[model samples]
Target chain A: MLKTIKLGLIVTLLLPALTYAHGPARVKVIQDIEINAPVEKVWGIIQDFCSIKDWNPQVSACEITEGNANEPGAIRTITLENGQQLKEKLIKIIPEQNKIQYMLTEPNIKAFPINTHGSSIILTAIDGGKTKVEWKGNFYRSFPGPNPPPELSDEAGQEALSSFYIAGLENIKKLAE
Target chain B: MHFHNTVILFLALGTSLHVSAAPFAYITNQGSDDISVIDLAKKQVIKTIKAGHKPAGIAVSQADKRAYVSNPESKDISVIDTDINLVLKNIPVGNGPVGIAVSPDGLNTYVSDWYDHTVYILDNERLEITGQFSVGHSPSGLDLSPNGSKIYIANRDDNNLMIFDRHKLSLLATIHVGKAPFGVTVSRDGQLIFVANVQSGDISIIDGKTNKVINTVKTGLFPYAIAHDDSNNRIYVTNQRDNSVSVIDLDKCKVIKTIPVGEYPEGIDIDIARRQVYVVNWFDDNVSIINTDTLTVTGEIPTGSGSRAFGRFIQFSDLP
Candidate 1:
């Protein structure tokens, strides 16, 4: 049994079949916030992949390790306030759709309790010049077996991702407003 | 998406069954642990059958008049009698059974164990395990040749495809493919083999006769399952991350079109009889029906949560 994955990330997105190949069922977390600002203003606040550190208070420090910010294949290492580091790679930046997609290039169980995580942030214009920010992610638990401890269980992974996205979205709304 | 289980209508076995039965798509919903049977003729869900925990991979066998579903979490396989649309038996297979396929004759069924790295052979009639053999790490997709002579297994971690003799269960050849290959398919004539590499985000086309890589077609991010449309001499691949399907022209061996689908599309199968393609979306919990001629999404039927019909999920209507 090979415990370590040869690749840094799981390419196939979310499904229980892929979960069987790695760990438990993949958990999906979606959090959104409405800000009293225009879509363009909100997108400008977090268009850069490295801007996550400025908007998300939990990310203490951020640096672009490879390629250019917001470009495909770009790698960024974000250091959390707790001192845990996780690497994420930019997959796409769709200006027309006002959506940005990225995934974790390195798994940090202590930080997120997940093996792999793919996420996207989208901004949609609503009524009254308000902008809606939605942060969504799909990830599997760090533990690879059927049974996992309380800290590394699926619930823990979901909770960690939900809280992370909620905090980020709230801050982005505040900043954009 | 919630489907009323009460509206499910069972097809009775007889002459009327053959006359009324149009092609049906069986979707294995992982989140809800059930199967959503979609009536292709009506383009709506016909029934929902409760399956084992975390049902994912599904293979339909017209010869056996049954469909086998892999439940990795439950560590077993659920056999469904297609006629009655009910679970006939639950056979415990291995540590983690993910990918599955039934032989052309419907006499044997192969199950891939992700954790154990083993392929188990089962007697479809007797509902018993007949043989088991080792393969590369994390076998995720299983496909048999048209003649049922050779079996194709995609080793996700090893980044390779293994060819085995269906009868002897002996290794024949191992060909290196792109990174993290998840779904595999063979042409109708068994002339070409297609492997969807998830990590590489491309499809490796192999010469079935020589067992060598012929060409590589780039797809949207994280290509998962593939569906071959032989009539149009093209193939459709589900891009999980891209939320779209890349239509590949077999003649040019290039992606001709990209059709946007629901979020997190995983499993895909072609209804050749109806000239339609069914793609299961995990995040959206719906199946997108594509018009083959137009290469556009014509309809979307809400299915159970985490709808992943990983294998050949569409049952032909001509079968009795």
Candidate 2:
């Protein structure tokens, strides 16, 4: 009975470690570019939520469903290149300040179920002749889901997310310039 | 006319002779929850003294023989008696104390509160909070001028360095640096301040006299800490992501060598007496000793459990 109790205690201590072996991963990417245009000009192109499909290469289509296009609490649906649809809510938006922040809300990607996606874009005038635009995103993932998937490694998932964001930003820069 | 001439001559000579000494490197070890005492004599961790919870940043006063260590979780500064290898007091500071620096006269210690975005000034003699000044968000590393007239703080969230007049506590300037500036150290001659841009993986060299960024030198991936060795005219930067140390020659403002170390090298300290460098690796739970002259790893000292306690900062003293 003593040996059995000791074994039970040992299993209890190791249970969490074994159960949480597979977890989600986080990835953050920041990109900046100096556009030879005024802040107003660059901001105008980025302010329209429906125009993301025109400028962003990866985003096939996007539409704001609720609230003003550039206002907080607005919901936007975006379709990726592979027909993966993602729904996001505008958490904060300030046109005068040339800042926009949004978080992914619905139609979660199967590879990153325990992930939160947030992105912020800022535009500032530099030397009156050019505008400096910065785009940054924070992607977080966690493990130990009810049903764990073998293909959801942290490194591979984060790499894919970072590359996707980079491609989208490059396309935006090309359109703005 | 002759009396006036004599007085002026004496003042001029005194000012020329009052050059400040080079600052000794101080590092706080978060893994051991203690401060490793490095004696420049042998260039080794002579002793490890207990401090508060998760000691991260360290500031030392060569004149007063006291070291102030910021304990982020404890929200206080652990005052260690340099001569005694013991924590004399844990003075309550602001929320999430991270960066710490002492004034030139050794009469005051300023600690950067990470959570509150404020710098708390502690009166050394009284051992109490004297005043506090607002800075940018998530202020982490700090450096004060040799004359105690200015203090520079690195705000991590804002990605900028803030300058403040030490006496009036007024804002001086805010210089935008690269992504996530975490550690800062001023040169001994008071001419340059080097800031480690963690996310950018580079070091920003600020012209101290001009208050401008002179240049940004690339280091290893995720450079988190920097230390200046005035005697050798070299700057040491610890790269957390690459687990390496980049030695920069101050004159050329270029990296001279990269010395690989254990996993996740985060904090660094230099021993001027023996011309050695100590780097703390967070994941490996050991300190890599490097010969500054040769720029190579000489030895390694294991601290504790091989967990990510982030053996973050390090400091050296002559006492123990």
Candidate 3:
């Protein structure tokens, strides 16, 4: 009877953990950059996920598994630093308007699990071959259970993501030139 | 051809003798998503022009008879025609454009892009963005000197006031002030610049000549806007969280009186002709009229519904 009571208490505590682990962690960052290129050139390069590996130092490979490239519902697997993987889906795409929106779908991070990820990239051509590329996104973590670790805080995560984008943009500029 | 030449000759004579008229005030209504045309002589909202999403800050150009409305959600500034009271064009600005100020000569309109931490310089005549200047984070309110020599911008994030030369659009100096500075106004004599520090609930007076903070005067909670009454040598500050207006004696650098107003007064304008103060209450949905002589609420003008839809930034002008 004593053993049964102890087991019941242990189950009560561990059951909540099991239920919480089912949901992925959430992370969000909103950033923008003004790229010096034509709107068409910037849009073309951003749409091709495979080219991201060439410019983005943190990203090793990106493969589109479903839907058309740059189209809604398109899924892509991305390999990040240290061979870690993340899956994302293109939720929206507007080529004529030079806007793209996407969300993270797979390889749910346990530390900073992404509950929802949405990004919008807009390209506006300014004078003298300059295109203002504004990239903004919101990330929400799954509620309940473990919170994001110190290194994976919203501010730090955004800084890392912005750096990656800056690197990729510099590469794009070099290639265009 | 003779008749056309005669008409052109009269037009040239008229243009040469043209007098600089008083500028019209363009007030952006965040709640209504429209711009209110205030005819200063009539002292009323003459017309409302539809603008982009969530219009907040407005700047008027006397030279071109145009107004720019900053719509944060839309990420653009809606350009309006003063004569027709209509949106003539929408110029794409940066993210979270909150505050706008036009040059004294009405040649350029400086828009503070809050989230992007940049100011977009739009050429008034060309109606295009000519240059961009980086400033402190989350710039909220902007004001230009009467002489059109310097532009003062209140950066909320850094709690600092940034000065830029109007001609070059180059950052001149950054003056530290109270916490969360929001509204900024330069005195008529060009000697003092008053900044409302929202978080500190006070106003910081900056010496324009020295480019340094001179004094700090306590205001009500969340002082959001400030305007100078040159005729009376007074400065009126709107306290949003406190729902009151604090009258500062400019010469003494002290609060003369704190008049009880409607809920969450955000925008303030002083009518020198009538010696009356018009304050837009964010929550009360009305414009509180205060008699400057008595320093009391004399009347109230009903505006939009809810706190957010109520009268926001107000400008008093004589233009129709």
Q: Top TM-score: which candidate number?
A: 1
Question: Candidate 1's residue-wise lDDT over B1-320, tens digit each?
Answer: 01222222233443234343658889999889999988878878878999998898999997876789999888999998776687878999998889999999999999998878999999987889988999999899989999999999999989999999987778999999999999999999999999999999999999999999999999999999999988999999999999999999989989999999999999999878678899999999999989998889998999999888889998874543
Instruction: Give every candidate's TM-score on chain A.
Output: 0.87, 0.73, 0.70
lDDT of 2 by residue, B114-152 (tens): 667799999987789989999997787898888888998
Give the best candidate by lDDT: 1
**Candidate 2, A41-95: lDDT as tens digits:** 8888888766678777778888887777766778888887778677788866678
Decide which is better by DockQ, 1 or 2.
1
* Interface C-alpha root-mean-square deviation of candidate 1: 3.1
| Candidate 3 colliding pairs | A25-A113, A25-A114, A26-A113, A26-A114, A26-A140, A26-A141, A28-A139
By lDDT, rank the candidates, best first. Answer: 1, 2, 3
The candidates' DockQ values read 0.31, 0.02, 0.02
Clashes of 3: 7
- What candidate 3 gets wrong by more than 4 Å, as runs, is A1-177, B1-25, B40-43, B305-320
For candidate 1, list the clashing residue pairs, or say none: none
